[model samples]
Target: MDGDVENAPLTDEQVSDQWKRLADLINKLQARTDTKDEFNARPGSSLTGDDAWSPPFHVSHAVNACIVAGADHLHACKTLVVDAHSLHVAAPASLIRGSLENMAAAFWMLHPTSRAERVTRCLRWQMVNAKNARRALAPLDLKDPASYDERIATILEVAQRHPEIDIAAVKRGFTSTAAVTYADEHSGAALGVLLPWQLCSGFAHGFTWANLAFSERVEIPTADPDVFSVRFSTDLTRALYLVWAATNLTESVLKLHAQRSTPQY
Candidate 1:
């Protein structure tokens, strides 16, 4: 069935039927309301110590982002299933890539060392925001310079409170390359996740190769656009793989949160 979908040029009816199957599978997976609830719940702090588990602000934020990404991926998949246009499908491919990347980051942050790295990254992120705020404060004749000054002051005040965050050190330590490398070393799924990510990125960036999806060769030349109708065919195997990957990442994140929530006896 999967081979037929991938190899044969499907009719409009076949395309609709395949889309229905894909939508049904997504719906079935999404029906696990309890899991989704647990995912959204406030995560506990520590896993094994006498101290009560209280998730830090960053940990909570990461979990929230992961959950949101999962939902976004599902939504994108559903949208593409219905639309099935070459241009429209690129949006979901891009979304899935982003979701996978976020999952990878969350996985790395679950570890102690990686968590520290993430903290440094957060500090650097704040620094970048401050820098941008400063740039916005640049005097412009049309814009009110005083208003920019007030915003810049507010940002600077916040920055002063975190005097311990060495911007240079944080910049040096918080690299995405290092994070992905760490994930690869530990989880062993980095490459598998990244391969699809790269492929999707090609489509997102509007590369020539990606545009080949819209190309069709016909033995008989036809002037009518409808003569060679190009309806996007659903790749069941790819859809199933995406669903499985999203579910796996979701489970891993939830398990991590649960592990941290429970204290060791």
Candidate 2:
């Protein structure tokens, strides 16, 4: 049986083809939206009234966002694959890590209780963004005091509207590591995702261990009596792993959405 046979290793051409196929799938998925209108309009659909605030609706929306984000990262990886000679493995690996983290969060948020916590975390995130934007505009405001008044006002409004987020707590909760842990607790794929997350996180953070993995020594001969140039060539394995993981995560998100959308008759 085919299942009994061990799989052969993929050749370079086969890997390239897989990348192209993944890119195509991402493009198709990105064209879709998560609104009720789109879902109810599908052929043989039975959705009648709006379930906008329901758990399934919210879950579907989060999954759709995850799909779009995953597609973007997949496309980026595809571009890097096409230009393998100049590939910077860390760049796409970082993006892939981000996409996976988002997927994990989406899955984690699918539960009834987690949905409210997700909202709180979102508000906390927005608060951080607003604070950062205000700080960035602080200097510009010196040139024209009114230049960023509206922007500052908007940030303040958000802060006033939402219950104050404990900045330290929020920081602790929203880290990539924390997201992965949440996934491990809620999403079944966490065990598979943890190591990759750690590997990519090291790269993204410029850890010595991660950098060493990509480093290669190359010597360039000089015309002068005794001069030489040495440079490092990055291994493409990280990038390949990133692309593969992204494709799998995208497919998982799509399947989750499909299962959620199906009528429970």
What's the lDDT for all of these models?
0.49, 0.52
Question: In model 1, where is the ten-residue run with the lowest total lDDT?
Answer: 47-56
Per-residue lDDT for 1-265 in model 1, tens only?
1212245555667656766765665555455432554444332334222111212324445445555665567656666654553334456666766666666665655644333444444443334444555575554455565655564454344334454434455434334345444444555442245545555566679664643543232334469855753334335444444434544454555566566555434
Q: Can you give the TM-score per candidate against the true fold?
A: 0.54, 0.59
Quote model 2's TM-score.
Answer: 0.59
Q: What's the lDDT for candidate 1? A: 0.49
The candidate that achieves the highest lDDT relative to the unseen native structure: 2
Candidate 2 off by > 4 Å: 1-14, 33-66, 83-86, 111-173, 184-186, 214-231, 235-237, 260-265
Residue 240 CA error for candidate 2 (Å)? 1.4
lDDT of 2 by residue, 106-189 (tens): 454443233334444443333444456657766775546454555435434433433542334444334556656665554444
| Best-matching candidate per TM-score | 2
What does the lDDT read for residue 11 in candidate 2? 75
